[model samples]
Target: MSRLLSLSFFVLGALAQGTSPSYDYIIAGAGPAGIIVAERLAEAGVSVLLLERGNASTYASGGRSLVPWNITLTQYDVPGVRHYIKNSFADKSEYCTDTPGNAGCILGGGTMVNQLAYIPPQNVDFDDKWPVGWKWTDVASAAERVHSLNPGSTNPSADGVHYDQTSYNAFANFFSAQGYTSVDAISEPNSKHDVYSHAPYNVKNGLVAGPVMTYLPMAQAMSNFKLQLHTKVIRAVRNGSTVTGVEVEVDGQRQIISLNNGGRVILASGVFSTPRILFNSGIGPNEQLQIVAGSKATTNVTLPASSDWINLPVGQGIKDHIIVTLNFNTTESVDFLDTSYFIKPSSNITDPYSHGNGILTQGYQRFTFWTSNTTSDGSVRYFQGTCYASGQNYVSMKLYLTHGLTSSGALGITAAGNTVYTVDPYLNTAEDKYAIASFIDNLLVQTRKADSTLIYSGPSTDTGASLSKVYTGGSHWVATAKMGTDDGRVNNGTSVVDLNLKVYGTDNLFVVDASMHPDLPTGNLQATVQVAAEAAAVKILALPKQQSLSSSSSSSSSATSSISTSSSSTSQLSSVSTTSSTSAQLSSSASSTLVTLTTSASTSSTSSSTSSTSSTNTAQATNPTCPKSDGTTFTAKSGAVFLVECYVDRVGHDIAYVDVPTNRIADCVNKCDALPGCVDISMSGTACYMKGVVGEKIVNSKYIRGARRIS
Candidate 1:
């Protein structure tokens, strides 16, 4: 069939009745990550199939959840509509019913249903938990690609205005009084410690612009790309360790879609659904496989024989951010937005909604802040807080225990073919409970100290046990199929996927979504999922394609990719050019001007703690001829190619400092190259500082920073 006709069939949901179409790549789940992988692979001149269990969400994607007055826009188009959809519109169709927890089942997945917040992951998010080759330095450029493709705005109004600032104004003042530094978070992603910033929403021209609005259209425009909606992938069609295709259910009819020779299959069905797929495919733990094997009533589909089962820890290590809500009475006259505006668009041209410049353009949360607490065990755990106006005099703060938490849960598939949480991932550990309780207690004390007028009349004094009972998950689920150096098939190994994101003991069967995230990120997970998909695409494309399997292999040993060369494996994917520049570090025309303001609060009594800031004044380069602030590639005299940025100094992870007496930039690069663990360098005057990892980046014109590019 012609490409156009084929695409039309797929787009119109004209189910392929009996026959299976061959494709070079078949991706399960059309979430932000799935669509991104589909687009990237299609762009590489490969035939791709992207399957979505849910239908289109955005109006542009044929969504019809429109407000009465607006025929051109759907409910998903508006940013603030997220507040209403979760319990209303989303429950009927957008939310996954098969999973016990909340998860988006629409075309864009979480990005389509979420609050549209576009907070990117901090460097420590990857540096701390991710395995080698998936670190901040390796995936930084991939993150930048996602950021460039989907630009965000703190103020999303078409008129370049912040529509509802009452809540933001009040909270910004409150956080400032608590000694939190004000920052444009997108510009300074590393400023997670004791910092507050305007909430960044991913929208364009007053409409939701996520993977559905950005990458999906690009994929649809390509002849090689086909999107099949209303198609639920049951499981991978596994032949020994090789995944030949996927068995899916369309309109209650089961079908097996085969892959082309040497093709690949990627599971992006999300944290819960992906593991379910693995379990159904006989690739999970023995206990889960046994349940599936005997579940003739729940799962009608025939399962692979017990002898072919590949035991791996697919549903282990599930994690979600624990959220604690605190209500405060503010003296500031904060007006609670009329949520009716979301369901009914104003017909009057004079109204801001007509111009897409009203409160409807903003998300529920006006401002977001980050804080950290050192637990009694001497380990630091980070927490993120978002403030939103709950009522005229009432403001609600949601405190999320984000990265560095040591709590985990398990996921399991029931005999009834439903995915359920085997264990809750809340404050399961005493350390996590203590950390959250202490953090809240400290925050309450600070709030009282900062503004005595702010009345707290919500929950009573929260002890660790009480807080644990009251806390709900942030719904940022991740790490079901974790990526790590250790193979899950091996004894004492904890990872389901390897560094290349390929599932252990399976050839050409990979996971590219939150299911593979080793840990939860610092903020919302959509942006991080897209970045990971981008990085995974680059790695998957660079690897040599596997030949068609003629006969199934008898060996049940772990399947390892040839992508890694050594223990570090940073430069192993040399076939794919890797750059060090990150989305957080990009200086773009669309970049918002950072308005950093110092609060009037005295810091004399504040704790001398570690923050995500760099002291650039003490590390200034005295040489007057320092390179300009333009992002340029510089080659060292010793033949090391580095991506150099002037006026940029990396934060933390200082290896050592060497004095380049000649005060030359080349000398600094050479010095960094000579160091054993140096991956980047920051030079000021004659002092060259070598860094093992690129942490948070602070703007400083006095120094030149170079991140070695792996070509």
Candidate 2:
């Protein structure tokens, strides 16, 4: 039977008699992606178990860190006091203890405790290095789905007012005079070059809003879905390449929750925790696997044998955006909001909180701007500056070297199973140092030009080691389990997961969180992370159930011994369909939900173009056969033409590849044009290899090459 049909039956059976302890999809971590993916899968009429290591956060989730003045709401529900939850001193309940760096462990994870800055990703963020199906054009609709629900507000107060104009005016004048266009940053996401705007946050009418508010509630209402809080997933139980289930810790007792016939396990536990889980499951570099085996505190738990270890670079290339702040004494009069606001709102703020409209609703930072610089080596480095009231008559701009930074660090698991950053991804490289110093020098020049009264309060020299030492981490970790076409199980391969978000060399094991991102995005990660999850769900749902469950039956043989014998009574079915026995049952529900719940915007289709050249290319593909082994020329929508070569393979300089549908030649041309630095493409059947520098070309009949006709 098909996996979908089997899972549907399991759900119906469980609802009637409560027979199986297995689930169709077991998602680890209750972050934005985890919630979104679980909701979509459950809406498809399949059983899903969403697990979170931490307890409830935010009042909706049972978090009761109530605001001192108002007894009804918690600090997590308030937009202004987001910093309170982030600081360990104020509240460490949401903090992840296993990871050395800061990470949220609560329900909704980072989304629940974040600054709520909802900066939409720039188009170049996807078009630059992401794989084909994840390109800007492909995922634009998915991003729109998130934006439509969480349309970030510039004026968050219910009264529709920019409460504090003192800091906004000071910085706005500085940036506007420097020729930076003042825009709604969230609306014009691509305007990252020279723009200044009021900080846009994922807030609505003075309340914090995110996936917890939007996606999680829909999932909670579904009968096929069950959210298990405080259930910590220790590691995946796998029989060689097939993952059967995850061994979770509930109330200090280890238990295995097996997958149904075709169930899948998706790890969305951020960058650090995802890698740690993989390592514990013996699915990482030999050194890490050895550490996991050697570090076990108890012999009761059985781990995957050494011979079955999947040696991949799981914790390599971990990244975080390095932040550097500059304190300036501005002549403009502005006072910082006092910390006492957390205990009791000031007389000026009390009226606004009562009316749900005031200065208290605004984010700590008021104005934000973005800039970029091209180094001598021709690499562009991106920078973002956020201005906030630091003190009386003082403002601090926290400058972030957001995108295009070459430096990266590593994450590793210690003998005690603690995850820590082995190397800090800061200005460790000379190139990064030069880029940061150059950006600061240029920024100082601009500050002087924009406002003579804006005086630098820090070091006289803001260029070298002195400046670099003052940098803090942005805490936006990503790429610990990097995603790409290259399978990491092979020698010298760097990718941990494939284009489908499935972990390489493993069946039914995937990652759908920040860990799957190949690199850091251009802005705050929440918006982009949510969009990627939506796109990933679409791709995962398109796959056949049998293909996903190829080794499910055989893997069960090894799973029985380590699997939990006790069945969990924690899940409660609400409104599951009792007679969902056909495979079409899942698809029918999934299609309707994808259109309405997941994808709010109309899907972008490529067949609408009227280019005669594309029509000619498609005419050749009418036979349903692969294109000619060799070719001559083609044209893209950008009016750029390409010279095609047959039987040639790209040796290096591979940015990413596109899996084209009908017109392989025409689709390759369009994909190359969409990618930023794609100079050439090597087409191999359905796969079109997009190249950045076009290093070395060799003859291989399995593929054809297309080099752009650079005028």
Candidate 3:
């Protein structure tokens, strides 16, 4: 192994100086990417530090709560209460103030605030936009892992039946009559054209569930994982093209967090904030960095000199789904469910948890995927139709134009050091405008054919030109730090990260979030972002060991003195280091170990493993030592027999159900065994559905069937 002593001295000196804590890996932003990466790294026995700009979304803070059928849960946990994040009650501290965008800053990031729409990106979404080593095949296992950890459900209600289907029935009947195929969107995730499906959400038993309910908990359970909430990262402490640590402010106290020798820093702070941090660190376009350096607002901090800057395209090729809403008035007979009813507590506020049934459980939105044939180039531009109950006796149909749209924007920093979208990515291209017009016209025709009573609202007669004026981003921003083979810093290219998601000019710095997406997907981005993080974890684990730099001189120049040097002393003395004095003083507070690195990148294909604490760690039924039958028997505490394909219905009018939050099949069986007269149980995605009796035999591929012991 190539051991460079200079780097080790820098780390040791930082620790000796006593400025801030040190970690093997420091991940920015506690979003999907950050949580997943932290979990994986911790599982590998590597020390990880995850930083978030917002506080925890716990039930005690009224940010997340669940009261079942009676009253809605907190704004962060309930599906119906999600609109509060975008309304007047929106917490400014938890959102980005630079632009009109809505990027979550909380512990779970967007997962805590979004509508929980969960759908995998189509194969084409990856095959078209991503470069080599990041195609659909590369991320397929990651997608499966995410689904297995936080599976989406078409029937999220405890009763296994969809509730308040007035809007759904209207849209489904209309679309089905017009030759649209109806399928379970979660089961068939890639079927994106001429198909209508229930809104597949990442909600389990009435709560907004995803990384917040799964990955975050598992990572927190590990001793090596550390989290810092309500902390803001200013910039990276870098020397030339290398980053050694980060400068942060926690509770108004400035500190410098140093990395271990040959340590790495992962930036998963979404698109806007990720680029903003890089720009502040003098790692963006020369002109953009000049703007920051010349700004009076940035004068308080010692900005890097122009000679030390690592000029790259930090913020470019930004993209978002363009949205257009179509409103319709429902008939007197068609009863519309009031989604805003959850804004205030209901009369049944004290009702017991009903396993996610009632209005608060579901997102109350039905979706339709359609493909447009009006494009002259024949590119695969698609549209997403989200019909939801809104206003008084009205249903609003939102049409989101996505996939194959060529419009893009750019992000830059202002003189005040705030991030801004200098160029918005809404209908900026001729092709996208044509596609939107064609999609709207065709959608209007379909609606008329489906239900004549449904009236048209604004933009009824206008073409794509007029609609462009009212279009808004779908809040699915991506590609600011775009990843590709082309280097944006040279040859008029436009990619910031290389194929491995490493910044073009840096070795140890990586971006594993939506910011690295080369293009937007056909559906929601949370699933794909998790997939990217999963793949990144494996790629990072496979890299060769990083060589540390060592030197005898105690000066900033000594940090990168020479590449050829050997030092046997593990404890070397160095008074001076490459980073500032603040970094040296902060490093003494924490201790970290050097992580083992693979000698070479692994050439094996990636596969999903369910051994993590958040997943079901069950032995495969094919094991010869295990009992073999049509059902997979498990070791349950209450002597339960697990049948592979059985279910129960009609507890309370076939509605009342209980879901125990446990990943182990055996533990789930034990919960069912403990229940009185609980004859049947169905388990899937960290939830156990218990029943009073086996009313009828129902086959469901998604769930594992279990039965209680008669003895």
Candidate 4:
């Protein structure tokens, strides 16, 4: 068969397929991190496929509002209703199982169900837990971008007033009187040592707006961007250390999702699922793989041989804030509301959205972060407190022992493929125990001095045994797939990924979520996780492009030549001279004939030549019916068809396009094929353009024509 006919068959085969659709990048989750990275890459004109285990959040889709606000909203959009998504309606399919705490399985991941605390991590959080290249200074720019895009408002009501300031004012007074600096938490994000501030949330106009409202909309607007919901990624399909694609089950039907040439896969499936996916793919410690390998269900598909497994400590380094709650009665001056109001949204709920002076806009009215006395290791221990109305006329203070805790834990998979923390993170060390106890005692003393009218109703002494019973993971879990320079596969290192967030043994696989954190930060992790993803996108874009199998020298170049000929009809001249070996030459007389050329190690030259054929012969060989290109006539490939538009004057008509410095008609076609939704291409001088949409098709010779395969 002729090369033109072969090219035609390739196009038809691609369009006829229903199961496999390739993309340049495949992201496994649609959380804040995943959505941010996807948007950035898609903005840069790379095709992306984002898969989410849950459907779109009700907030974006406009679900029913229990309270009549004259505006459409869902539980996800309201700050007061946020707790209902996880606490009241949690057992619904949107939540994950086998984890000690709840993790959202929806499109926004944890952001969909989290309390929306938008505090950025302190500088010490990065400098202490992150790798060398991931220090605060290195990530400052990304941090700034995240904060700028989603700066949660302390007072989100339309009205300029704060809702129930009774609890907040009391705590502020107490903390301030105790010598702790009072500042805007978000404004002084780095100063978490001894500060009390009103809690900052991603809520805007009384709505829980986050990445779902920002990055996702931009990505969804791009033609080359696609999202598949309710798809569960089981494992990655790999050959040796290179991942070709992922195996996912959509609606109970299993399918293989392939990647385009030189493509990448980013795992942003949270701290638990990210590691579990790696383990299922046989990319974890040997002991864990052995457990997975023994399960028929897990090993039902292709399993890597023992020696072929990438043995990194994937499930190690698990950490979470240790939380302990204390209840206290507020003075007569302070008023409170109970959780019942959240269930039955009162008529006053609209106050925040309409006037910005209601209780619905805030989670916990006040929050505090402070340090305890230095520990034996010379590290300053940290603690966080948030005071909110727990019930009628009663306030609850949830204290989180955040920083300088040396206790680490482990996550393991069950026979059913559920991720669970085999070793919980708690006060495992004597120093950690002492820190928690002393910290609680000091807080009690301060509260007694600051507000003698208040009455305490919790444990007086922090007996290690009593505290252990009450202490649990703060639900701010992190560090399952740690990132560091140390290779976990050797030298007793425990890190799973490198500083670049790439899996230790793979080239194209990366972890861009909380799973890559070396340790937990001192504040809510949502902001830091987002900043890390932004930084990861920058690093991934800077890395050298991965070479595709077709780009190899061993592949036949005849198809490429045929595609090039159909798009640009230069002369069928003899061999072109080069710095190295010369490419095979075509006979001058072989005008309409198909020819095969052998691979050559030659540097491209900028020389041109034409065949000495008669005008009639030239016209016959190079069909004038084809799109005009620089006075050169070209023949359309037999099976390939394009919608040609000429004299088009519109600029920036395409949603996204790739620019090649040195134009090659064949290279441009290949690039378009690799990108999803690529419909047209144009070449002008040395500039080659790949466009998503073509506005007009005029009959001007100045424009080169291209078309998307429809058959």
Candidate 5:
């Protein structure tokens, strides 16, 4: 009813304000963080004006709701004799080519149609990498706010389950047998420690229930808030410390998108888009302005004194998780591969989203990571998210360098236009590259250990092939609007926003999104970025008019008093009650041993928190183990179906299976019959991983690829 009435009101309002819709606050992009900030401010009784480049129906895909990738993919790029469809993340949204950098020109930014998985970085990360005056406590509060503001935005299965829990448990157990530990986590902001599982979604029943559905809706309801779609903000109207409003494009016509001088302005545009906005306004790295615009420094938008020229690093230390995965298929018998995850996955409904679950829900043809691996792990070293299409469901194992060093990427405007950014992400650092290579090696090794022949491998598909410069740079990009001690390189190190999140030279203007993260975390960037936005908002609202702008001013008396009003009071949308998963029935002796295995597991930094610790039921040491199926040990065999495998539970899980290393798809199905429990498979090369609970010993079976089960 509310949805319908809101629709009617919007129509009437559009008829009324079609000529000119005024607003108090204007935000740039409509991605996850951008939507969050807009919603937060609007709720506080402030008029918010959001300018979105895409149309509203962007989130709706007719009645089908199927993203573009959901339909086409299989039509092309498959393995074998012909028509091999191998569309990696390269064809997803952002459509970044070898050169042309395009930001999502649609509403909801990336969130309207991203994997939509939400996570929070570990406590230690905020405590260490983020700037002074910000810590785990501050961030935790923010995460809580975002989730509370938008809770359970996902679809649960027809049954009670959310994802493929059995498969996840099977593989997770295998890791435990190898002496790994499990982390016990919760979705609430209670600050508990646990290995996180399927994070709650903002998708309600096959819908992309993100900013467009939640924050944006609430903000739109307020008479104080106004949203304008199909509009692009060119730059902020500035006259020193004061932002008059914005210059925007509406109906392909340029117009002055005004905001009250007293009302604020926010750069909610994403990382790529935000910096461009700043640069166009003559507020970025000087060298960038000169090179891109061929300008001798033209626009005088009122910057502070020359001494205030912060020689701070901006858009440096860019990083992302590198991924590697394999797959397998046989017949029907738990064919949860193509669709249908755990109908009763043994996880909490309030679980925070992550990768290790038996099957992934948040990732459309994707998977989550953190994977209890390296600490100070690999980071975004100048890689961009390329696209094969706007959207698709694919599998990938994202890897993070818990720590990043020795390399940096700069986001500079190129003379070509705002569309082309100088993507000089240096990925050849010996240490960083090698570390990436090693991580890739670990992925192959881990997957293979679960099922020997689970991948498409050959002369073309080697461990080194996974390290192809063409492979990755996940969505997680960070350190652009960074913090820390002022560095003279990469422009000014003196951050754009201070500890309280207020812009250094200006008053009221604030940057409360992923751009403010000083250091990239070890894993996905969404959770951490959102948390930063949360914390920034808390501080922003607490700021007194006079106290916020002064860098030297201590906390204001009024502001402090306001802060004291209610430390526990927050304006979050709602709260999610986390239910602890019923503990596994371990033998008393096994439980005692398990305690030691889990408690002693170490935690790494530079990534989001969630330790799926590998624990051993040493006492029972009799963890469920798989018996090798192929009579013979897995060897690099020819003309045979090989399975590349990994342990999800104690049992083996195939990454992918294939028929011929000789490069032929002739006998794919017959190969599966030769191996036991080989349910289904996806062939890439000669590597073929079985799809069942294959044992600890990865089997390399010998069979031909002829026919597969169509059923």
Candidate 6:
């Protein structure tokens, strides 16, 4: 075994890229890739270390900005709630919220903060865009594996949108009339195709559910798995010629953790964070590191030599979906965009969440995604816009720019404590803006054909417009770390990893996030990322020990490099990774719900109609507030810090809601706030929704299945 790696056994090491004495595998970042990778290794009986920077999202429910408020029509815009939204991500770019992007600070990562749509990319996309050995079938199998772990429902509404179908059909038909196709299911994204499915939501029955609730928990159950939450991996530690482990922080204390060379280290951090972490570890270009060493950050930092920068590309190719919104008033019955959704100046924050699910309910979330046939590569994205606040409404049509021409962006740190990520994701090529404008024009024309009312006569031709402005960027970012056959170029490059997702230089490190995409997909990135991660996990598990043969120097997994290594460490690590994460949990299913009941299936008498009577009346409550499965009141008065409202078959039970008092909600919200395991939480009513913790103790309530409240 490498001496440096061996030192990790007992040394109080804190270096970024030096080898430690021991550990089988070390995973960085806690999103889907990290979770699934850790789960697979732990299941296999390998000793694994899962490092996450964000706090665990196990207590509260849904949005952090909304957590401080109560959930009801009365306290909709409570002063604190409004202030919370205003102060949310205050340090981030104003457009971070203006455009819709999910950059969460939780254990589950983006999976926690996302809109929760589920999807996969077209089989041909992988087959065509990727290099040899990367086939659509392979990725499809991986996607199947992922879905098995985190399956979504085909049906969202119980009775299937009685009054809501009209709006959807109208919106879809209008587009179909102009050559668009109406798909009932979400399709695997294709750069040149269009299809639909019910938006594959991470949420089922109005609950947030994702990987942490599924893969990570199963891995956690394994004694071999050691999870380190709130541990931020600053950089990779290395010896003269061999890679070692990572330097991380826990509770403000820095520690150097090691993984034997025969042991594998995977960089599963997200696109934005992954490359940044790698660069900090001295895996990036020399020119960049020289600048870092000169900064105040260099005092405590120990950077590796420039040769460690490996010539292959890493975080250069960035891609994503760019959304172009069009707003219009429908002639037929339409979800009131300005009324229930966008709030007025006079509206108090008291009645935050409206009762009796409004248009935002009724499957108003029903939207479609398609990739254009354009030869140029652009992105579908949004800059925080008017419709993106804690109280903003009006769902905009997202124009996904699947295959943009631009390559990777610079992943570096700012003089400030925060990481500064700058990418010409769009306008990276002469054809960039043209492709976007062209696609938007096509989408507007087609969608207008679907429903003439979905229009917003732009006062300005600029694309960045939000509900308040035009010509703003969309939030569907992807392709920061691309997958390809060869290292294409310097600035504009081919990719960093292979079609099989093996990083160029490394032995076992693989990338499976949106950044690994050579080009953007046909639709939203979550579905495609789903397919990619699933495929990567399966392929990784199928390979034998040291299976990688084509690995280059960039991926951190090369075997021929000038470095001392040991197969014994690898073997020892293997001993801890023999079991699969979901083996015991998958006794037919990972989660067992109480047979979800639709409104039509209900034999019990519960009022299904909405009343004109105001919620402030608090008059004549109908449906009995059934006791929580524990036969306890789930409301604030009951003293429960967290309440499980909606549940998905995420793990052992279903996705749950966490309801607590406004005073104590933040603490409870912090508990589950940003983790992918949380689905949704309602305030004012003082309830937090929690996912992934549903247990066998649950009792199914016919419950308010739709967005409507349980009056």
In terms of lDDT, which candidate is strongest? 1
> Candidate 5: misplaced stretches above 4 Å?
9-23, 57-102, 151-155, 162-176, 181-202, 291-314, 324-369, 372-407, 419-423, 426-428, 443-470, 484-494, 546-711
Q: Assess candidate 2 and give its TM-score to the true structure.
A: 0.74
**What are the models' TM-scores?**
0.75, 0.74, 0.74, 0.73, 0.59, 0.61
Q: What's the lDDT for residue 530 in model 6?
A: 61
The C-alpha stretches of model 6 lying farther than 4 A from their native spots are 1-22, 58-102, 158-170, 187-198, 296-299, 307-309, 337-364, 369-371, 374-395, 404-409, 421-423, 442-451, 460-474, 487-494, 498-510, 542-711
For candidate 4, write residues 598-677 as lDDT tens digits.
11211121022122211221212322222222123222233233433322222223444444322334444455656666
lDDT of 3 by residue, 141-176 (tens): 456556656666777766576766777777676677
lDDT of 6 at 200: 48
Q: Per-residue lDDT for 118-153 in model 6, tens only?
A: 555556556656666566644543554455445554
Tens-digit lDDT string for candidate 1 (1-711)? 121222243354334322336777899999989988887676554667889999777655767675444454567876767778756553368889889688888888888767777888899999998978888987875665576556577877777888677888888877777788888877788888999988888776566777776566555544556788888999999888888899999899988899887889999999889998999999888998888888977678566777888888887889999899887888778878666755554444215654556666777889899988787788779989888888987788889999999999899989888888888777888899888888777667755554554557555555445655688888899999999988888886889988878888887899999999998888888889989998888778666756742111111111221110001111111111112223212112221111111111111222332122222211223222223222445555455566655546666587776655444555676677777777787653234678888667743322234444332
Give Cα-based local distance difference scores for all models: 0.70, 0.69, 0.63, 0.63, 0.42, 0.44
TM-score leader: 1
lDDT of 5 by residue, 1-711 (tens): 122233443454344343434455677776667777775564444456667766553212111121222221111111000111113322243322212332355556655434455444566667656766687744543554444434442233323454544334433443354444443222332222212233334343223344554455444444444566667776666666566677777776767776553566788776676765665554556675444355324322233334433333444454445443333221112223332122222334213221112222333322222333233544323111111111122222333444343455667655543533355544546666665566556546654553532222333356743554544455556555654445334353546567765555555556666666766554445656666765565566455543222221111111110000011101110111112323322112211000000010011210222223222212213211111111111211233333322111112355334423222222333456556665444232223334554433311111111122222
Question: Would you give me the overall lDDT of model 4?
Answer: 0.63
Question: For all candidates, what are the clash counts?
Answer: 1, 1, 16, 6, 121, 139
When 2 and 3 are scored with lDDT, the better candidate is 2
Q: Order of all candidates by lDDT, from best down to worst?
A: 1, 2, 4, 3, 6, 5
RMSD of each: 15.0, 13.5, 15.2, 17.6, 22.6, 19.3
**Model 1: runs farther than 4 Å from truth?**
1-20, 88-91, 348-351, 448-453, 459-465, 548-711
